[model samples]
Target: MNNYNLNHLKELESEAIYVLREVASQFQNPAILFSGGKDSIILTHLALKAFYPAKIPFPLVHIDTGHNFPETIKFRDDIVDRLGARLIVGSVQNTINDGKVREESGRDASRNALQTVTLLDAIEENKIDCAIGGARRDEEKSRAKERFFSHRDEFGQWNPKHQRAELWNLFNGRMNSGEHFRAFPISNWTEMDVWQYILSEGIDVPSLYIAHNREVVWRNNTWLPYSDLIKLRPEEEIVEKLVRFRTLGDITITGAIESGADSLTKVVVEVASSRQTERGNRSDDKRSETSMEDRKRLGYF
Candidate 1:
């Protein structure tokens, strides 16, 4: 116990930096999945710090559901431009137009589940051998079992039970042709750690996290934002509420929590004291007990 004086945050930062460097050194065509979310922003910032004086080695990949928040899109483009990194968008609209996937019909239907197809399409089209994401173990039970270097089959399907052993950070990145890997540099990080890291690093994120007044409707025990994709019920009346998004996704599925935590410190405090998980706001995951698992098996991230 005497030698445990090292800061845990610093240790996590070191590990993430190591993982970033490993991706650069190992993969031929790698890219970071940037969604303009807080986690992605932190991941991108760490990548820049990992290779200072040298630009990020890989491009940024975003699977646009065509239902993202306007602020998120603006922030995404701004970050890419500032970082001088290439941005590739895999649009769900293109997938629908090409008949690759059909749009869901219903008030609860969302494009969140459909993102996997666009993501896989982007990977194949770009010939990307590795995709670094901001996925964290604490976000969901399925993600808890993920490795820092999670391998995917030729079809981009994940086999949790058959995953390769990662002992003492000795990652085995070997994979056959047509097979790629999803690397989570911040796999061990928790929501609290993410907020703390963002505060420490002064990373910029979308304004949706901060409290703002918006016209919302109470549905499915969560506050659903008013969107063209959402169908209104006669009983569910829209009202102005001070709310903030805990997690960003397809506008129809992502829920907002009533909050007044406008600043980063306040946000961190809120997360630290909250009893519910971050994904609690994601209606897509609420559809089934194994929703995330089922989606991940089909190449969802």
Candidate 2:
């Protein structure tokens, strides 16, 4: 007889893989939300592994806020091409031009909030029944209460309190017409677990994660990337600094921290010793304590 004991991380990976298979086996028009971020990249890799001997069964969707790093866009295109997966992009700029959303006017204004409208529009236009995301519970307080198969109403709104109870790995994917599901395959993984898994699996990530010298401005207590979209107040000044992005988002709001962690091993060590949450670098969440929760209620992913 053979005996096997799975570690916690392996158990999580197995569970995520099972969820990926379930999405493929259940949904009719499923799509994976791929932003080329570490979380999404890991999810894509896991999906590939889950369906070994066959290409991913779903298309890749990117809700483009029009403020992403060039490296992230390049990585997104490259991965989609390599995997032969279809890519769908919903542009926020288009939404603003069409008057579907309004662009904010301020020194720190960002299109991050407007991305929700574009994302929902994309889902409706593409008729995507299920959107698989890489959102993890540890990322935010509200996200911690998310289910593996999170249901969304016809308007794509999330009711956190009314979520179905998941028991014994059974998921109730039943939904009414026009309603959809937001599936999170890696909902239980934490930042440290993600870094450790990336290191262990030798996953390829964007160069922005590694320490590099770039022109940045001090804003909101973190170094903001110097970009045309980034407004500079009279007090703010740009300077060259050694920085790396902990989480990639709109250039106007995403913060980079001073780091020398250039490799996956170094990154894992840094994450293990870090005190701040990964979303700490994201300025959108800084708007309010329940910002993410409110956004989720309003149909934001």
Number of the predicted model whose lDDT against the real structure is largest = 1
Task: Using TM-score, give the best candidate's number.
Answer: 2
- CA lDDT of every candidate: 0.91, 0.90
Q: List ranges where model 2 is wrong by over 4 Å.
A: none
Q: State, as a TM-score between 0 and 1, how close model 2 is to the true structure.
A: 0.98
Clashes of 1: 0
CA error at residue 296 for candidate 2, angstroms: 0.7
Clashing pairs in 2: none
In the predicted model 1, the residue pairs found to clash are none
What TM-score does prediction 1 earn? 0.97
